[model samples]
Target: MSEHDFHVHGPHDHELEHAAQHEPKGFAGQLAVITAILATVGAFFSYMGGATQANAALLKNEAAIRKTEASNQWNYYQSKGNKQNMAELAAELVSSEEQRTKYRDKVARYDKEKADIKLKAEALEAASAQADEESAHQMHLHHRWAQATTALQVAIALAAIALLTRRRWMEWGTLAMGGVGVVLGGMAWLQL
Candidate 1:
């Protein structure tokens, strides 16, 4: 061909050119862009959901460990009580005054140790409760993120249907669903 008549078209160029001329200008492009944006947001929400779930599990594990430690401390406190009881009995049964005084001293020491053990056990129990509460909160956030992801997925599906059916109302529905997804994601971020 002469340079004046020379032309080049890629495989889809003719089809795209014809479509651009026949279809409503920018409608397909707008839908494609919006769908892409929604997909990206959905991916982020999905990731947040997974992260929150993992955090909840970890917090729950921490709570369990703390609870176990508290149990152990309480057991130790009970052992000290038993020792104090044995010393009190020994003091009562002793014949010598000097031996009785020694048993009393032992009993007093065991009482003090039991008090310290009791305080530690209580503290650990409080910590375990706090961690358990935090874990529950994380699970709540995870649920929010999961809901947001589901809404975005629904929006993406609606976009696909709108494209296939060429329905304007479907496009509006897609936008509404996407907006709901964004709101849920925001709520998740705010821990509400």
Candidate 2:
């Protein structure tokens, strides 16, 4: 070969250019970008799942505390009942009219107090039940978010495999998994 022809045609450019042309057409690169986006979405779903679980736990604790308070109030009601019974028995045994009147007055006060305590305890127990219901609802929400996160993670894995294998079927698999993730996330968002 002539020196002029050698200078015009370099060895490095043609071989590399030929190989570059044979590579897949931007499929892996696009898949990589999509996988990254899906991973970000997965993180969001994971965060929501964890947060909802924590909220549910907090609500459950609140319910327990309210229940304990109700129990304490009921015990107080029992003590008040015992006091009223004792006063009625003493009034029966007393000879002085004034002493009997005083004991009767005490019975009335104790009865009124017990009625208020019973009402308050019942209200607190109802509130505890409501909190338990709310906690269960939050737990359901958490489960939905967890399912969405799992689907998203699977989609991300499928996308990575699609990028590595460059198989069109794998791309479809990734799309299907991503669709499932999106549907689950929508259900969570709608609280359904």
lDDT of 1 by residue, 58-119 (tens): 99999999999999999999999999999999999999999999999999999999989999
List, residue by residue over 38-121, the lDDT tens digit for candidate 2. Answer: 898889999999999999999999999999999999999999999999999999999999999999999999999999999999
TM-score to native of every candidate shown: 0.90, 0.88
TM-score of 2: 0.88
C-alpha lDDT of residue 111 in model 1: 92
Candidate 1: residue pairs that collide: none
Give lDDT per model, in order: 0.95, 0.91
The superposed Cα distance between candidate 1 and the true structure at residue 44, in angstroms, equals 1.1
Lowest-sum lDDT 10-residue window in model 2 = 1-10
The superposed Cα distance between candidate 2 and the true structure at residue 60, in angstroms, equals 0.4
* Model 1 alpha-carbon drift over 4 Å, by segment: 1-22
